[model samples]
Target: MNPSHRLSTFNITTLALGLAFLYLPIVILVIYSFNASRLVTVWGGWSLRWYFEFFNDQAMLDAAWMSLRVAVTSASLATLLGTLAALALSRGADFTGRTLFSGMLYAPLVMPEVITGLSLLLLFVALGAGRGFWTVTIAHTTLTMCFVAVVVQSRLTSLDPTLEEAAMDLGCNPARAFAAVTLPLILPSIAAGWMLAFTLSLDDLVIASFTTGPGSATLPIRIYSEVRLGVKPEINAICTLVIALIAAVIIVASLAAKLSDARGESGAPL
Candidate 1:
């Protein structure tokens, strides 16, 4: 065989294996979700029993609702704060403690979730703040904002400051200039940040487990507790639903962005 052809075959094999390794478990979980029997491994034929059971599981349903609320609120707050931090870091002049600020902002990205969760737990306890829904929200927002900031900062660094300057030159104030020019350009990045934050908040188990109180257990917390009792078809159903939702969001966003880009390219002057 030709060396290049052999190398191409190897590369294709590696890629196929890598993708299978990553996705095979999820695919199996989704398939098993329809199993009629309680046993996860033994195929008892296809049925919607587990999905139906999942909907009827009141505790899980409530936890899902709570998780949704936490994700939306945390993602929004994180996007807002993260955008501001990104703006400052990417645009602001050199100042005292700027280095420290940058380091602290990105620290959570690399820090162990356990350490971050434990420290937050301790801080809440020392502050006498009650641990519940809001505690979880606060904790999630803190953890996800670092991710959001990184996303937004990447966009901001590449953004043209001249656009904002032109808006100012056109008799716009700083805030108005941003709203009129900068915000529109960065809106996609902000949306990306929000989506990232939402996903992180929803999938988080460690930080949430540390901060959540009895009544405020998120889906991951509930899922963890159930999984400790051994695997269930209902758990598979839950995973399927979560995966589907995330996939749907990604698909819609990609299509919308593609359409927008197509329009922009069509409208551009030759």
Candidate 2:
């Protein structure tokens, strides 16, 4: 065989193996969600029994609702604050503390989650803020907003400043020019950041464990508690749903980005 051909074949085999390593467990869990038997591994034919059981679990339902609220509210708040931070980093003039501000903006990405969670937990205690839904939301917003800032900053850095400048020259103020010309172009990144924040909030367990209070358990917390007892088919069913939600968000974000590119190519506002 040709050396180049052999290398290509090896690369393909490596990629396939890597993908299987990551996804095979998820596939097995998804398939086992439909298992009728109480035993997780032994197949006793497929059915929707687990799905029905999952729906009937009131604690899980409440936890799911709480998780949704936290994810949506935190993601929205994070997206807004992150976009502003990104603008400051990418567009604002250099000034005193600019370096420090940029460092703070990206620090969360590398910070240990335990340290972040513990510090926030202490801050809440200092503020006399009771631990609960709002506390978890605050913690989540703090963590995920940094991720959003990183995403939006990349888009802002790559964008041409001339477009916004031209808008201002054509009678728009600075803010108006940004709103009219700059925002639309960078919106795909903002949308993606929001989705990422949402996923982070939904999937988080450690930070939520530190910040969450009684009667305000999130889905991950509830799932963890259940899994400690042993693997239940209901847990598998819930995991499948969570995976589907994350996958859907990614697909929508990708499509939105493609659409924005198409609009840009056609000389339309994007």
Candidate 3:
């Protein structure tokens, strides 16, 4: 083969290997979720026994529901607060201590989950606050908002500030100008941040473990505890369902974003 062809072949092989490395384990787990036998390793032909069992497990169902609620609440709060932080950092005039403020805003992005969780746990203890649903949600929001801020800040930096100014020049108030012009333009980023925050909060295990109180176990905690005893088909089944749900959400969101972009581009003047 020519040198260019050889390089193309190498890239293809690398891509294939990388994808297999990431997804092969997940594929095995998904396949075994339908296993007829109790053993996870042994393929006992395909059946939906485990799916039925998973749905019938009231504790697992409750934990899943709780996780959903926490994820939604935290993601929304994070998105809202993160957007505000991004606006301050990206749009507002430079002020004293701006660097310190920026560092603090992004600190949680690099902070270890264990450390973050421990700090929050200590704070809750010092405040004599009960640890439960709201505590878990707050912890998730704290860790996730930094990520949302990063995403929104990137979008804000790329936006044309003159668009908002032009709206204001057209007699719109500052808030109305943002709502009519800047908000629509940055909406895709806001949505992307929300999805990312939701995914992070949902997949979080370490922070949830530290902050969760009695009767507020999320799905990851429940799954981890069960896996400690032994891996069960039910665990596989539930995980597969969770994976499917997340995948569906991502696909729908991606399509909506693409459609929005297409419409915006089409309407722009030549």
Give one digit per residue, the lDDT tens place, for model 1 in 67-126.
Answer: 999999999999999999999999885977889999999999999999999999999999
For model 1, state the Cα shift of residue 44 in Å.
1.1
Q: Give the alpha carbon lDDT tens digit for every residue of 1-270 in model 3.
A: 677656577798999999999999999889999999998988899999999998899999989999999999999999999999999999775878889988998999889999999999999999999999999999999999988999999998998889999989999999999998989888988999999999999999999999999999999999999999999999999999999989998999999989998999998999
Runs in model 2 with CA error above 4 Å?
A: 1-7, 267-270
TM-score of each: 0.94, 0.94, 0.95
Q: In lDDT terms, how accurate is model 3?
A: 0.93
RMSD each, Å: 2.3, 2.4, 1.9
Per-model CA lDDT versus the true structure: 0.92, 0.92, 0.93
Best by lDDT: 3
Ranking by lDDT: 3, 1, 2
Give the TM-score ranking, best first.
3, 2, 1
- So what's the TM-score on candidate 1? 0.94
Question: Which numbered prediction scores highest in TM-score against the true structure?
Answer: 3
